[model samples]
Target: MPSRLRARDRVQGPCLGAPAYGSAVTTPRLVVEEELLRRNIDRVAVGARVAGVALRPHVKTHKCLEIARLQVAAGATGVTVATVGEAEVFVHAGFDDVLVAYPLWLDDDRATRLARLAGRARNAIGVDCTESAARARAMLPDVELMVEIDSGHHRTGCAPGDVGEVAAAGGVRGAFTFPGHSYSPDGGSGAAADEARALAEAGKALVAAGVEAPVLSGGSTPSLAHTDTGVVTELRPGVYVLGDAQQWELGSCSPDDIALTCHATVVSLAGGRVVVDAGSKVLGADRAAYSTGFGRLLDHPDARIVMLSEHHAVIEMAERPPLGTTLRLVPNHVCNAVNLADELWVGDQRWSVAARGRNG
Candidate 1:
């Protein structure tokens, strides 16, 4: 432990111990505790098994092959991604099965890329409309296709009834949806129900169209726990493996379930505030409408990141630590925060963010 910093909880270790995090890997570095991370993986894996739902967890959360390997070993049938680029990374890394869950706008170049990826691994692309579905088949003829349904997120995916039209366009394997609206005020269970209903109806619609809707997938972290198995066959909850402040606020995970935290150092202090050298550039500027702040101090749960510049986070703290003290902060959105960093520290060893910039 650092001679200067006193002992506290597990989160306070890097600060209290010598070879302090700041000295090893500058400030504002994303870190993953292996034990906690494995626990999270196990938590979700057990849940999926008990619920009798297939687990094909989204890998955009960690973006690390090491973490994805852990998830696969734990029981994830396959890994899910948001972009074609992400699928390429994992496929090259030997992930046999992958699903680009987002409805991608495939330009000619992206089509050729998906074609090559399909040859290397069992990859599937998403299409929410007939135009995209036709584009997917004509361009990347080798890959499987999943028609996206708008359970409640309304971000992408078509209406459940429209699934038949998209499937009729041909080459569709099944249906998928994201209940992102589950992030709202106490909306997990209800959104889960909504997702099941939408996907079930969508599946029947696809079958009615004679498109063989075998794979029915849907899930997000918050709504994952309440996700029932009937309409949704495969579940993909990314953030459950590395939770964030938003997940904590949604009661999706406890403080202990959070495995990813940023190691930031207190640079200065003012009346009623402590400034840390980690900000939106590293912590991400993803404070959801319902969130309390941009980030949360791990050691000081009550402290809120009141302000965030590109390189500084202004925290409101009751008892501030001295200057140069390292404090671990759990970001509001772990997925975005991880994307901001180059590598992650698992205690002393460094792990590369293999798919950091693989956002297509």
Candidate 2:
């Protein structure tokens, strides 16, 4: 039925012949492949380079110091963090440039720590209100501040038109927006355009009020590809480095690009379902309406993850896999799933989660 193939085709599958009965066999554990990570990193870097924009990748997705170092080494100008503790960890790890992207309500201890940290690194803080600005100014007056504009995320940014007032109150040095609402499947180009317009207007407003808004930053992995460079000077995309089900659904990445996965072994099989060792505790419960299941089965893409528990993940397999077989599970949200593990096994090497429980 088919034509004769070359010698390369005959020497397919395993390069070597099948193993002997007595040969040693070892299973992979918690794998984070270096090749996958490099591919994803290069994809984002190329996209930003083509658009002539600076990429300050968000490190909140993967809180590993080794991964952060890899991101920086891969041409990332700096890193964006979500918490003071995160920033402190990276600073102590020797990352000189950091942006605390969250609008923090600084208390006495936090203010003192932030001030000290700002003095050490090229640091900047986010401000959404006058109270935050006053607190930051009182705590770290010399530290650069960015007015957080609400570019349709409606999370923690001020109104775009209120940029001047917010900047004036906090003595802000720049302006930035998250543009997180652009994650929706239908909200790609339109949302990015709106975010660009909002950031540009906010930057103009801040400059008009005598505040020097030099850093106009706005981006997320979903909007990173669609963003216009004319308005935003810097882009901060976190999940692009290690794609998740959300990124896959948004068409931001392919299945092969997913670098992180839960290496779980099937422990039981009953009721026409196979139960794995990993559950909500390891994989997390971050199902979206568009998502087909809780997580994806790496070996068997057709298998559906029907349910998840504290230490078990139930899969509705078409043809049940062996009970002892190990399956790789890619999470719906890589950030939360990563937070669950104390360490990650990259190939044969193990790396510690330096910032694992640093969610303050």
**Of the candidates shown, which would achieve the greatest TM-score relative to the real structure?**
1
- RMSD of model 2, in Å? 7.4
**Which candidate number would show the highest lDDT if scored against the true structure?**
1
Estimate the TM-score for candidate 1.
Answer: 0.93
For all predictions, the C-alpha RMSD in Å is 4.0, 7.4
Q: How well does candidate 2 match the true structure in TM-score terms?
A: 0.90
TM-score of each: 0.93, 0.90
Task: Report the lDDT of model 2 for residue 114.
Answer: 78
Residue-pair clash count for candidate 1 = 3
C-alpha local distance difference test of each model:
0.86, 0.79
- Candidate 2 local lDDT, 1-360, one digit each (tens): 233444333322221111111211233234687899988888788777878788899888888889988888878899999888888899998999999888888888777777778667898888888788877887777877887888887888888888888777655767888887877776667779988999888888888888763678989887877898988889998888888877887787788788887777667777667887888888888887778898887656677787888888888877666656667787888888887777787765788777777766
Q: Positional deviation of 165 in candidate 2, in angstroms?
A: 0.6
